[model samples]
Target: MKIIRVGEPGLERPVVVDDAGTSFDLTTLTADIDGAFLAADGIATIRRALAEGRLPTVDVSGLRQGAPVVRPHAVWCIGMNYAAHAAESGAEPPTVPVLFFKTPNTVVGPYDDVLIPRGAEKTDWEVELAVVIGRRARYLDSPADAARHIAGYTISNDVSERAFQLESSGGQWSKGKCAETFNPLGPALVPADELDAGNLRLWSRVNGEPRQDSSTADLIFSVDYLVWHLSQVAVLEPGDIINTGTPQGVALSKRFPYLRPGDVVELGIDGIGSQRQRLRPA
Candidate 1:
């Protein structure tokens, strides 16, 4: 089952899409699609409803699809999890996972306009696979158990500004990463059972040209290990999201290419879905 949120901003509702491509309302059944739903045998119940022909179908068009999950407690990110990206960023592969935070408010639905901040000259784009936590995970060493803790997967654009990221305040990356509307998150949150979080092809294009393109197989740390490693340091709550990092083909990788005003960014991953966002002047 592919779980999603639809409606306007705060009024979003929980929904599930069946194999027939029909969307059923899960709002009346669940207030929101969060850790609780994923925790209480949600996938099985939805599948059962579909089998019984009791599920309702709604057109996916018209209504705005919000991020598959709402206000995730934390938005954790891994920088340079892709070897090529690490090389482009002029950073060596870390001995362990390198983590950072994107404020929860930075979260926005897929296809939303990515506002290029005023005076920004280094705005960039990154196509990444985001992981949604389904259960409380902590200190698990085995990668095999990682899949069990994942609720679903989604597409993400880890938009950034190189100047604020590398040159400002000496070298704090958050300055470049935390701009409003920086992270455009999901087209949908596909259940882990329904899709392969690893091994899918991912790509991002600017205007009409390809820029970033790679497969999840290129990830330095697989989703399972990243989750397990993170759990060792903190509680992995339901509804939390982790951006597994981007591949090498970013603007930062190019010698002199960067997004200017009026650039459109299209990004996607197979199975999860795709999103196209316009870059607007702030």
Candidate 2:
């Protein structure tokens, strides 16, 4: 099932999209889509409600689509997980996953305006597959155990500022990744069973021009392994988001000019849907 949140920012209401592409209001059943709801098997409850024909379809024509879930505990990211993306950035595939963090406040509605931080001159874009955790996971025994802990999948634009990330930060990427609106996520949160996360096509475009175009098939560290590996060091909790890296073709490789004010960026992953953000000065 595809789940969504719609309304003005911070006032979003949970919603579910039916097989026919119709959206049904889920506010009567849940206040918001967050860790608490997922931990309680909210998806299963929604399914039961649908089967009983107890939900009311709602018109969402003019509503703003908020990030599918509310503020998560943390937003974890895997860097250089994609072989081609690594090559483009002059790095080799890592023997272990390269993890990083984007402050939870960096997340915003998928279609919201993205601000180019003041004094930022090298802002860039990365289209990645984001994994949302559905349960607590710590020191998992195997990668195979990851499936049960996953809530679903969604799209994320891992917006970055190159100068802060590479030149002035003394090597920590988080300096460039945690700016407000740096992570634009969702249109919907699709359940794990509904997506083959290992092989979807993801891409990005700046003002209608293609930039990054690649597939998850090239990931050096797959979703399951990243999850299991992360659990060995940090507890992965419900509503924690993992951005599983990006494929080649970002402005960071010097293949395209970095984003500037007024630039419109569009990006998405197959099945998970897409998002558009207009750049503005912070």
Candidate 3:
């Protein structure tokens, strides 16, 4: 099942996209797609509803797509998790996963306009596969346990501002990562059972030129390991999002020009779908 949230921001209605690409309103089953719903076996419940033929189909032609899940409990990011990306940034691959956070407010619909923060000059883009947590996880026994806690997957553009991230902020990457609209997420949330998180092709393009083209197979820390690793320190709650990390070929690599107002960016992971964002001045 491909779950989605549709409508204007702050007023999105839960919906599910069928195999035929038709959308059905899910409000009759749940109010919003959030932590409480996932924690309560929401997906199972939705399946039951579908089997009973109780869900109402809706016309999504003119509605805007919101982030598939509502604001997660937290938005955690893995830094330098891709070997080539780490190499591009001139850092050795870490023996452990490097972590960071993008505040919840930074999340917006996948197609929303991304704002270049005021006075910002080193803004950048990253294409990452984001994991949505389905169960509360703390001190998991092993990476194998990680799969049961995953709800689904989606695409994210981990937009960054290089100067704030590296040069002026004393090495805190979140400083550059927490700007409004910095995280553009979702066209739909493909359930864990429906997609394989590993071995998927992911890519990003600025305007019409390709910049990053890589695979999740290149992740230094696999999704299972990341979930298990993070659970040992912080409690992983349902609806929490973990950005698995981006691949090589970002403006930060100095191989491409930084984004400016009027530039359009597009990115996607195979099967999950694609998203496009227009750069706009703050």
Candidate 4:
């Protein structure tokens, strides 16, 4: 099952598309896909509604697709979670997860325009597997506790400005990550039960040229471990997002030119879905 939102930015209507591509209006079921809905067992409720044929079918033919979830209170990110990515950045893979943040407002519709902040060079793209928290988690006993708390999976383009992040961060990475439209997430949010994130082909393309091409299997820190580890330090609230780090193909390694206005970025993760964005000056 894929949960989605369609329409203009602030007026997006909640929707759900079944395996057969039947679109159902979630307006009667909930106002929007947010923390309240997920925490209240919204996915299960939607399943039951779908089974009962109780919701109306929506004509989403021309509706714009928005980020699957509302702006999360916290957009948590993991850095260098992929071994090759760590190496490319000139560092050894960490013995533990490296954490960072992107302000909640950075979340935008999957197909929305991405802004290249003025005077910024070294803007980069990262194709990452994003985990959405469905239940409040804190001090989880083990990685096994992560599954139940995960509401679903989605694709996130962890956009960055390498200069702000590494060169001018004063040791803080969020300096580069927290820009408007920095995070393009989802064409759909697939329920966690329906997919196995352990192994999936996730890749990225910039201006039609292949950039990042890798699998989640290469992750130095697995999904469950990152969630479990983070819960020990912060409360993983429903609707919060965890960007499980990007694979090695980002421009940060200096293998390719950084993003510029007019460039197009496309990212995809099998099963979850794909997203594309056109860059323009902010």
Candidate 5:
């Protein structure tokens, strides 16, 4: 089943799309799809409610879609997780996970406009598989224990400004990463039990032309490993987000031009869903 949040910004109502592709109201079960709800095993509750016909059918036609989960406590990002992405950026693959953060406020709806930061010379797009935390994770004993902590998965466009990422700073990535509307997330959040996060095909397109075409199989660091490794260094609270890094084909590689106003970017994963965004001036 896929969890969806719909309505105007900051006022989305929780919804669920069942295996049969039916949309159901989750208001009787929960007010919103957020950290508090996920921490309480809302996915399981929703599953049971649907099976029991406790949820009412809802129409999502012609409505605005919000990020599947709202106001996450944190948005964590992994860098150089794909070997080819590392090589393309002139960096060697790290032995350990490389981590960073984007301002939580950067998160926006999948169909929202991504603002091109002022004076930005290298605004870029990165399509990544995003993991949402369900349970609190701290110093997990092993990668095998990570499954229970993950709520589900979705799509995230890790929009960036290359100058702030590389030239202006001494390689501090967040400066380039956290602009208003920098992260466009979701269309749906597929429950972990419903979708396999590993080995899925993910790709990006600009104006209908393919840009990034790769699979999670190309990741040098797997999802389980990233969760466990991160738990050791930081307390991962429920509703947190982990952007599992992007594959090659980012403009930072100097092979393609950076994003400009009016550019249309479409990114998708095989099963979970896809998202589209229009670039506009900040």
Candidate 6:
């Protein structure tokens, strides 16, 4: 099922796109799509109803879409996970997974405007694959076991500011990552069970020109392994999001090209959905 949140930011309602492509509001069952529903077995109940044909359907055309998950506990990220992206940034593949976090306040709807933070002259774009955790996890044994804990997938633009990330405070990456409105997630949240996690393709464009284009096949740490590894360090709570990192082709990797007001950014992944945003001066 294609799960999504719809309506205005902070006031969104849970919804699912039914078999006929009509939107069936899940508001009657839940208020917002978040960690609680996953932990409470709401997903399983939805699946059973869908199988039994007891859910109602409505017109999909008029409703606006919101980020699939609301109020995620944290937005976790992995850096330089793609070999080519690593090479492009003048770095070698890391011996261990590189992790970072984006404050939950940075979350915004998929099609919302992305701000160019004040004094940010080097704003950049990164098209990334975001994984949503479905249940509490700790000390998982292997990738296969880790996979079962994923609730779904969504498209995310891991927008970055190069100078703040690489030059400021010597080496603190969060200063560059925690900007408000930095992460635009969800045209829809696709349940992990419905799609092929290993083979999905991803690509990004800035103002109608192609930039980053790569596949999940290039990830240095597969989704399952990262989850397994993270669970060992801290309890993996439901509603926490993991941004698996971006592929090469960002402005930082290029000798020229940085975002300015009015620039448009777009990206998509197969089976997940696509999103486009207009860059505006802050």
Please, what are the lDDT tens digits per residue for candidate 1 over residues 144-202? Answer: 88888898899879889888888874756777888888989898988787777779999
Off by over 4 Å in 4: none
Cα lDDT tens digits, model 3, 164-272, are: 8888888788999999999999988988888878899999889999999999999999999999999999999999999999999999888899999999999999999
Question: What are the Cα lDDT values of the candidates?
Answer: 0.85, 0.93, 0.93, 0.94, 0.94, 0.86
Tell me model 4's lDDT, rounded to 2 decimals.
0.94
Model 2 spans with C-alpha error above 4 angstroms: none
Could you report the Cα RMSD, in angstroms, for every candidate shown? Answer: 1.6, 0.7, 0.8, 0.7, 0.8, 1.3
Error of 6 at 8 (Å): 0.9
Each prediction's TM-score against the native? 0.95, 0.99, 0.99, 0.99, 0.99, 0.96
Instruction: State the lDDT of candidate 6 residue by residue for 234-254, as single tens digits.
Output: 888899999998998899887
Give stretches of model 5 more than 4 Å off. none
**Model 6 clash pairs?**
none
Error of 1 at 176 (Å): 1.7
Residue-level lDDT tens digits of model 2 in 1-282: 789999998899999998889889998899999999998998898999988999999999989999998999999999998888898899988999998899999999999999999999999999999999999999999999999999999999999999999999988999999999999999889999999998999988998999888899889989999999999999999999999999999988888999999999999889989999999999
Q: Candidate 5: global Cα-lDDT?
A: 0.94
Candidate 5 structure quality by residue, lDDT tens digits, 3-31: 99999998899999998999999999999
- Clashing pairs for model 2 are none
Residue pairs clashing, model 5:
none
Off by over 4 Å in 6: none
Give model 5 RMSD, 1 decimal: 0.8
